[model samples]
Target: MSAAGPILEVEAIQAFYGTIQALKGVTLQVNQGEIVTLIGANGAGKSTTLRTINGLMHPKAGKIRFEGQDITTTPPHQIVAMGISQSPEGRKLFPRMSVTENLEMGAFQRKDKENFKDDTERVFEYFPRLYERRTQKAGTMSGGEQQMCAIGRALMARPKLLMLDEPSMGLAPVFIEKIFEIVVQINKDGTPVLLVEQNALMALDVANRGYVLETGRVALEGPAAELKVNDRVRKTYLGEG
Candidate 1:
C-alpha cells in the first residue's frame, strides 16, 4: 500500500435536500487497502453522504477529493470512470436485464475492454450463484442473488474505490454473512471500500475503522474494535444495553 494520504477524502461536507440539511459538516476518509464503515440510524445522512461523494448530489459546501484530485463538482459517470463506483442501497439492478447484461452495463463506461472477460470470471468466482444464473433476468432472482449481482456489477467497473450502501439489507442471515466475507476478500484484492451499513455489529466486525452518525453529524468515530465496545454504540446500535 502507498504511504501516501487517503485515496478518498470528504472534508466537512454539508449536503441539503430542498431546505433540509442532511449532512452537518461530515468529514471522513478511506485510505488505501482499508475497509472503512459508516454506521448510523435511519436519517443519519449515511446515504446522503455517499450520494454527495458519488456526484449524485453535489454538496452546497465542502470539498471531495479522490486520489488527490478535486471532484466536488464532477458528474456521476465521470466519477465512476475516475474509479469510484457504488453499489447503492436498493440493489438497483436492471430488473429486466439478464445477470450478464446487467454486469455489462457496469463496464459500459470503461475504456479498457482487455480485461472484460477476466473481470467477469472474477465476479462469478465471488458469487458462484451468479455464474449459475448468468442468463437469468436480474429481477427474477431471489433477494440474495440479486444483491450478489448488484455487487458483481459494481465490481465489473474495476473501481479503485468501492462504496457499498446497506449491502446487507433485506437479506437472509446466511447471505449476510457470505456478503461480508466477500467484502473482506474484495478489499484484500486491492480495492479500498467505503461501507455504509445498518448492521453495526457486522460492519464493525469487518471494518478497520468506523464512524457513528446521528442526526446527520458524526457522533463518534474510532477504530472499529473500539467503536464496537463503546458504551453508547453498544446500547443503541449493537443491542447490548
Candidate 2:
C-alpha cells in the first residue's frame, strides 16, 4: 500500500472564490495508505483545502496531483472515478431519503453494481446501527448516526483515498471516541485518509503525520507523535503547558 509517489499532492495552490481568497499558496501531500491530518482553528482554510482536492472548489492557481497524475482541473464526478472520495464537513445526507438510499448515491459512478451492493453490506458491518435504521429517513437520525452514514457512504465508493472533514464535530464525548476508533479501523483496512479536523489531539493520535494550519497555509508539519509533544502544539492545541 506504500505510495511510490504521493497519492495526493498540492503544490502552492491558491484557491479563491472571485476576489475572496480562502487558501494562499497552500501545499501538502498524503502518502498512500496513510492517515494524514490538517489541524487548525475555524476559518483557517482547512475545509477549503479538502474541497479543492475533491473538486467541489476549484484552484485559481497552482497544481494538484493524484497517483502522480495532475488532477487540478478535473471535474468532481470524474475525480471520484479516479479514486478520491470526500465525506464533507456537514454530513450532507438527503433529508428525505432513506439511509439506504443515501448510501446508494455514493456508488453512482461505479460500474460493478453487484459489488457495490456487497460494499453497502460491508458499510453496515462497520456501523451496525446503520443497518438497524436502513429504511429510516436520514434527517431523523442523530448527529453521531449521521456522521456514520456519511463515512459509510464514502466507503461505498471504494475509494483509494478518502478525505474526511471534521468527522467528530457536534458529537457527544462517547460518540467522538467511537468515531475516531472507526477512523483508525478504516485506515487499517487499507484506505488512505486525508483528515481535516478540529480535534487535534485525537487526529494526531490516529494519524501517521500531521500539518498544523494557520491563516490559509501550513504552519508546521511532522510525524504525529512528534507534533503531539511539541511545545507550541501542547500550549495551543492540546491545551497544556
Candidate 3:
C-alpha cells in the first residue's frame, strides 16, 4: 500500500480471441484506494482487459501483477483467491438460483466459512433491495436488481480489487445513478476498483482517474476531472463539441 506503487498493474498486455487481436499493448494501473476507470466504445477491448486480469483469458504477451506478484498466467479461481474479482458484463447470474445462493457462490473459494453470514449482510447494507429478495430466483428479478445481485456477488468474494464491467448497462437513469453511487461508496470503504463503463460522463464523475481506450489502444489517460474537460474527450466521448 505504498503511496508510489499500484495495487494492480497491467503492463503492455496483448490479448486475442482466436487469431484476432483484441488488446494492443494496453497498459494501466490501479493504486490502492483509487477508482480507476476505463471508458470506451464497444469492441474497444475494455472487457478483454478485465478478462485478462481475472485470468479468463491469458495474454500471449506482456504481464499482469497484483500486489507485486505475477498472475499473468494464473487460473481464474486462483486469481479470485489472490484477491481480484470481476463482476462481469451481462450480469451473468445463476438464473435458477436464489439471490442469496448466487451471492454465496462468490465466496466459494473462501477458507473461512464462519464469516459467510456477515459478508452477505454487508452486501445487503450496500443494496437493500437485495435483502428484500434474498429468497427470490435471480431470473425473476428486474434488470437493475439483477445488476445489484451481480455486484453484491462479487463483493462476497471480499476482493482487494473489484473490477466491474459495465455495471450501468441496460438500467434506467435512476438505477444507473444509484449503481454509480454504490460504486463510489464501495471505493470509499477501501476496495480499489477498475471500472469499465460506457457511461463516460458518469464514469468520469466518480473515478479518480480514467483511461480512454479506442480500437485496441489507450487514446488518452489522466485525472478524471481533467479528461472530462479535455477538448478531444469532450467531443468524442462526452458528446460535446
Candidate 4:
C-alpha cells in the first residue's frame, strides 16, 4: 500500500444483532499513522462499528478492506491474524488470569516466538502498570488497571490498525488523560488508531479526524479540530455551547 492509502476502509456497512440493525450504511476510513475517532451517544452503534471492522460482528451488508484487501466476510481470528486488533468496550479481561497470561492470550494466533516476546515488552513499555502487576490476576485489578491490561493485550497482537472501543469508559479523570496520552504516543510510534468513544470532547481533541455516529449512521465528519469547533457537535455531543 502507498503511504497515503487508507489503512482501514469501511464502505456502506450495515451491521445487525439478530435482525435489529446496529450500523446503518456506515462508512469511514483511517489513514496510515493517524488517529481517528468515532463519537456518539449511547446505543448510537459506535461499539458495533468497531466490532464489525475487527470481525467480531459481521456486517449484513457492504465491505471492509484492510491494507487494500477485501475482508468483509473474514472470520474474527483471521482478521486478527491480518493485523487488526481491538480493545473492546468494558475492558473484558479474564477474571482468573494473570496479567501476563492475558497478554499471552492475545498472541494465540501467532507462532513466532521472538515476535511475541518483543510485543510483550512493547505492551509493558506502553503501560508500565501492567508490567509491575504482571503476576496479579486481572479480575483483582482496579477498573483503570484492567483497562490498561485490555489495551496491553491488544498491543500484544502487534497490530497495524488498533481499534479501541471506549478506553475511557470507567476511568477516573486522571486515568482518562493518561490513556488518551498513551493513545497519541502509540499512533506517533506508527500504529494507526480507530477510537470509538462516548467522551466526544476528549476523543476529538486527540484524533486527527473524526466521524459522528447517530443511530447507526454518520451525521458529521472532518478533521478533529474542525469537529471540535462544530456548533451542532458541540451542543449535542461535546457538552459544549
Q: How many residue pairs clash in each candidate?
A: 0, 0, 0, 0
Please write out the lDDT profile of model 4 over residues 1-241, one tens digit for every residue.
Answer: 1237798999999998987999999999999978999999999999889888888788989999999999998999999999999998898899899999999999888878688888889988999999999999999999999999999899888899999999999789999998999999998899999999989999998999999999999999999999999999999987776
Against the hidden true structure, what lDDT does model 1 obtain?
0.95
**In candidate 4, which residue pairs get closer than 3 Å at backbone N, Cα or C atoms, i.e. clash?**
none
Instruction: List model 3 lDDT by residue over 23-89, tens digit each.
Output: 9999999999899999999999999999999999999999999999999999999999989988989
lDDT (Cα, 0-100) at 53 in candidate 4: 88
User: Residues 67-128, candidate 1, lDDT per residue (tens digit)?
Assistant: 99999999999999999999999999999999999999999998889989999999999999
* Candidate order (lDDT): 3, 1, 2, 4
Each prediction's Cα lDDT score?
Answer: 0.95, 0.91, 0.95, 0.91
Per-candidate TM-score against the hidden true structure: 0.98, 0.96, 0.98, 0.96
Over all chains combined, what TM-score does candidate 4 have? Answer: 0.96
RMSD (CA, Å), candidate 2 to true, equals: 1.3
C-alpha positional error of residue 58 in candidate 3 after TM-score superposition, expressed in Å = 0.9
What's the distance in Å from true for residue 70, model 1?
0.6
